[model samples]
Target: MQALGPWLPDDPALPPVALAVSGGGDSLCLAWLARHWRKNLLAFVVDHGLRAESAQEARLTVQRLADMGVPARLLTLTTLTKGPGVAERARQARYAVLAQACREAGCLDLLLGHQADDQAETLQMRHQAGSGPEGLAGMAWMSALPDVRVVRPLLDVSRQALRNTLRGAGLAWVDDPSNQDMQAGRVRVRHSLREQDEREALWRAGLQAGAARMRRDDSRTMSFARQGTFRPEGWVCLGPVLPEPEDLSVLIRCVGGQIYPPAPAAVRRLQAAGQEATLAGVQLVRWRSGWVLVREAAAMDAYGPAYAGARWDGRFELFLPSSVSRESLQVGPAGFGLDRTVRGGWPARFCATLPALWRHGQRVGIPHLGWWAEEALQGAGFLFQPPVPATGGGVYGWPEARGAWFAAHHI
Candidate 1:
């Protein structure tokens, strides 16, 4: 509870804090601990529906949470099916639903129950996969998502310790059979860490790596603040010289609206190829003085229905007034043939990647450029809301690093 201080808020009048309780021993124990720490808490139990008993387990989890005096909701994923990369698919779906639920519930922080054992396994798996230093850090105590902040309070606690806590309270938890499946990479790593010495060594290594990552992130944040200029049109302007690979990668992720940055080697290659190049859905072009990093127009998302709060291209968000009719309205890229006079001197390539409102195949609005087809469409707006921050997500649990990050990003 003391360690969760930085991640949780003290104000009771604000929105409730959320928890991701999976009915497993680890999450159940987390819920149990959190109930005592705060009065206003919401739990979300996600049902992937990958097994015959998943729905039942979710329901039981909800009931258990209710018994503990914590309100909970069951989120059932219907689109996921068994296939290649099913585990990754399920994980992504789970987070998406969790984030959506948090937004609807007015929750800012979502607590996850990733314990020390899971962290050790992640470190081992990433080591085998040739992951970089950031990957070797395993998981951060706090991570920023597009819709919410993910906080892992039990990252320092062992799995067995959580089960022991539940047992001490005379509580029972669901045991998922999939955890023992040998075909899974994490399961194999878990089995291999049967020796206490090996697990401890890996856990220590992850902690050291996390500390190093925090330092690097601080330097990157400083570099971005001094040398990077972020535009509201979803692009960036760099200083005379390109930033280091780590700082450049952060800029690429922000401009490209990608959840993860390009690999370190790929970023290095881009830096070496000083000429105009495209990597990770972003184009680095030479502009006046320094450089301009913009979204690759060719890789933008297809047209989608335009509503009051529609998000397009994962880089811009749409806002339409209630008086505006959404019928036949779609949001897509503002192509080259559109009126360039209203582009406010921004490059045509940059304007081509801007989100525009279309009606019956005609460009109706390019909000950022202040162009509209009619007076009524003037109320339409597009906000540059990229998937991740320009300075990268801050480190949690480390007060100095987290504070530095928050100050740098103005969060």
Candidate 2:
């Protein structure tokens, strides 16, 4: 519990902390530990429905949590189907639903139960896939997602230790058969780590790599503060010289509104090209003194129904006053038919990618450029909130640095 100080804030008025309980021994133990740590907590059991017994397992997990005096909810993923890459698909779907649940529950932090064994397996898998240094770091204690932070308090603890904790408390857990499936890469890695020495070596390797990665991130953050200007218009202005490849990737990811950055090799190639190029739905164009990274206009999503809090293009969030009717309003790119005089010196390419408000095919608002059709539309606005920050958050005790960066940039 002392180690969780950096991850959780001590505030009573905040929403309850959340846990992702899979009914497995690792997660059940986590729930038990969390129950003792704080009473204001919520647990979520995700049912992928990949197997017939998944729903029942979820229900059982919820009941077990109730017995532990922990409030829980079951999230069912209905869109997932068994096919090629089913494991990856199920994992992605699970996290998506979990994040949505956290948002609806007003949770700022979502605890996961990935123990040391899982981290070792991840390290081995990434090593086999030729992952870079960042990937070799395995998992961070805390990862800041767009909507919430995913935390792993037991990353350094072994799976057997967690199971033992549950057993000591006279608790039982559901054992998923898929864990022993040899066809799965993670399962294979888990089995290979039967030797304590091998597991400890892998865990140590991850720790060393994570320490190095944190040092790199610190330098990267300083570099961003020195040479990059993040505009509230969802674009980034860089100095005359292109940033380091990693920093460049961060800019592209933020401007493109992507959850992950473009490949490091692709970023290196972009930097080598040096003049002007486009990658990962972002275009790097030469502006006045430095270069401007902007979203590709053609890659922008089409108009979708606009409500008071609709998020458009994954980059901008719409806000409308209660007085405005959402019947005919739509949110999409600020394309043609807009008055040119209201552009306010923003480039046409940049303007075209901005999230705009439309009603029945007529342009009504371009919040970034401060243009609205009428006085009634004045209250409508859009905030540039990308899926990932230019300086990604994963290190522990780094929120203060992130908050300071945002404050200095007026983001």
Tell me the whole-model lDDT of each prediction, alpha carbons only: 0.83, 0.83
Candidate 1 lDDT, 1-411, residue by residue in tens: 565445456566888899999999999999999999888898999999999999999999999999999899999999999988889989988987898899888899999998878877888998998777777877878887767888887776778788888888999999999999999888988998897667767877887788888888887778777778888889899977887777788789888988767888899888877888999999999988889899999999999999887778887877789999889999999989755578777778988998999999999888888888867899889888876776547463353332321111111
Q: To one decimal, what is the Cα RMSD in angstroms of model 2 from the true structure?
A: 6.7
- How many residue pairs clash in model 1? 0
Measured against the true structure, the TM-scores of the candidates, in listed sequence, are 0.90, 0.89
User: Once superposed on the true structure, which residue ranges of model 1 sit more than 4 Å away at CA?
Assistant: 6-13, 396-411
| Top candidate by TM-score | 1
lDDT tens digits, residues 1-411, model 2? 554544455455778899999999999999999989888899999999988999999999999999999999999989998888999888878887898899898998899998878887998998888777777888888777777888888777788778878888999999999998899989988888788667767777887787778888888888888888888888898979998787788789889988767887889899988988889999999988889999998898999998876778887877889888788889988885555687777677777888888889988888888888856878888888887666657763222222211111110
